[model samples]
Target: MTVAPGPADHAELQRQLPGLGQAPGPVDAAVPAAHALLVHPRARQAIVLGGLNIGYELVRVRRRSIGMVVTAEGLSVRAPRWVGLGDIEAALQAKARWLLGKLGEQGERQRRLAAGRIDWVDGACLPYLGETLVLRLDPQQRGLALREAAAGDTPPGRRLLLGLPPQADAVQVRDAVQSWLMKEARRVFLERLAHYAPTLGVQVRRLALSSAQTRWGSASADGSIRLNWRLIHFSLATLDYVVVHELAHLRHMDHSPRFWDVVRDVLPDFDQARAALRDPVLPAFD
Candidate 1:
């Protein structure tokens, strides 16, 4: 249970715990009184209640919102400062069905992510830039490296080699690959931003990677852009499209037609990338 400091932090707090601060007011008195608590499949015991509302408590510090968040650590709820303990319990009880459903979905997502683990050995299939890349390890190769070869470029009777150290484990391989992809993503994203900035006549002040589960990306009025690092799993074209989408927001804060027009002007085929981004599999990573 954490409390945010100062009035300025209220908005930030509210964003985390949706409906806690600016909630639609209490449910009708006839909604029935009940006690509710967060139960995480990963937790050893049920989390104790802290506030009066239908909200769950989230424990992650970097998690800025107060609403429910499903994580490896467990379920968390962000309660508003003025909420009463009884009211919170009642709200949780009333919303038990919704919370349970969310928990199940999150649990499944976590399972899938764990299931997708790579063996880091020869013949492992890994996702790369929206496509699956097969690893072909060569023990004879002297050092660690990644080599991209055309599917058919291999010798008539020989397979292409993807040089990964023999001693590397799954976790190490995943990290190495992710680091390479992120570096490339940053480079390509910055280049695309620069390319479109001049055309849109806007300058980006800051850019950072985001791990947000609910949003693919977000842009602030202050010219800051936050893009999901998982986006590197998609194609370069799709990544560029998201960048353009956020950059356009600098000119038009809302998703109005004018804002879309700005995106279209820069990326005429933005629809393809948009469709690709809608893949339900992309959000599997929590």
Candidate 2:
């Protein structure tokens, strides 16, 4: 986090805003509603952009440039210590369109998270490998298991049965299902690594399952690979894309163009798989 030159202080930042010294407008029925559109309902800071209000959280730190990030929480602005409020506000205004679009995307992502959350009860539906599976209590000694949907049923797919009873709590259900998914992730990742290692002429020594929140997979120079177990929820093509990506890293050790060329040799349609990995809404688990 290096500091760069910016306006003198917060005063300058406020002055730089389009409407600093202007008088306040009258309160009308549309006033609250109109202001609502400009600001995020939960944002900590608000600014006027194109005569519209846009809300974001401003985090000042020792950084080189004013960086903006839009996540599940919302838009966040990071600025250098030396940067004045005016410079930060100006930058935000310049990127208003991108900011608004990202805000909308985060809203959509939040909606999907709500909609996709598993109920963790009998007859609950959960997503499995690009498909939906029904949850049923099968409290036999077998514990947790996935079974094919009954033949000729209306919504033809698979059913996952948990050994727990109908009265089982959410934590019990989530942990049991997660355990099974992780086991499958290890087996499937190993097979994919083995399948691509030979084609890429790279030898991977081990496969480690990762519960990392952000990183999907990483390859070390020592031929060890760590992949997120949540990947089991996605289709095989997405899984293979991550596998090839890490294996390619073994050859180049960096994300240079040549490294991607090696990946292209293995999976030609890598872009689609990459995009697929970025956009899906996974179930919420603590």
Candidate 3:
């Protein structure tokens, strides 16, 4: 899952627009055009900033200040009910540079994600544990078996010999792969959690797979852990960082310096692994 920047920081927004109460004025025409355009499906207002035509969604809320968010799609503005459109546009002009940068980053990130989407079919390839796993449809196989090639095979790595026939449809292949991946994810998670728990001196009471959209892993105060199964697609080192991070929470619930010290105690070079996990080009199962 590629995680884009969430929202414009309120402090940054405040700094950009020192005074939101300024009277509305005509948009400056002196700014040269860039021939860029961004539009939101629900946009109710439009503005030209830095020569980029932006159609943004405007939502009136009972707030004291205006908020701006640039997502993969486009921009959205939440403004106080008393604020007029002119004032909102003025606020936008004030933060145009920051907004445009975020929009460009998100747009490119989304493009990369789309390009990396998986195609469910015979001989299709997907990343598994930092290596490419080729899918092979073999009806004779029982369930899903991981088979290695004897020396030199055309498509290397390992074959996930699925039980489905060669004629299986895309949906069947996707579901079968997902089911197997979830089971394998649980088995691997348990082993890794046990491997690190004794060192961290934390007893994990329960573990479950999470399908959260925005979160990768979460730890509960009650000794329960929930990890995203999709993480199985990454390398073991990357997965261990998340495991160690959550376990460190057992001693200190907050991410204080002491919590980081606990994590570093186990994996001295956890930062490298953490950076790898942030790579946005993961295989999209959906």
Compare the candidates by TM-score and give the number of the best one.
Answer: 3
What tens digits encode model 1's per-residue C-alpha lDDT throughout 55-118?
A: 3342334433335555544466555554444434444544555555555566565666666765
Candidate 2, residues 4-56, lDDT tens digits: the string is 44555445545444443334333232222221232444677888754566677
Per-residue lDDT value at 190 in model 2:
90
What overall lDDT goes with each candidate model? 0.62, 0.76, 0.81
The residue ranges of model 2 lying beyond 4 angstroms of the native Cα positions read 1-100
Clashes of each: 19, 4, 0
The candidate 2 region of ten consecutive residues with least summed lDDT is: 27-36
What is candidate 1's CA lDDT for residue 119?
67
Candidate number that wins on TM-score, 1 or 2: 2
Off by over 4 Å in 3: 1-37, 43-46, 58-67, 77-90, 149-156, 219-223, 277-282
* Model 2 TM-score relative to the real fold: 0.72
Clashing residue pairs in candidate 3 are none
Candidate 1 residue 237 C-alpha distance from true site, Å: 2.1
- RMSD values, in order shown: 10.8, 7.0, 8.1
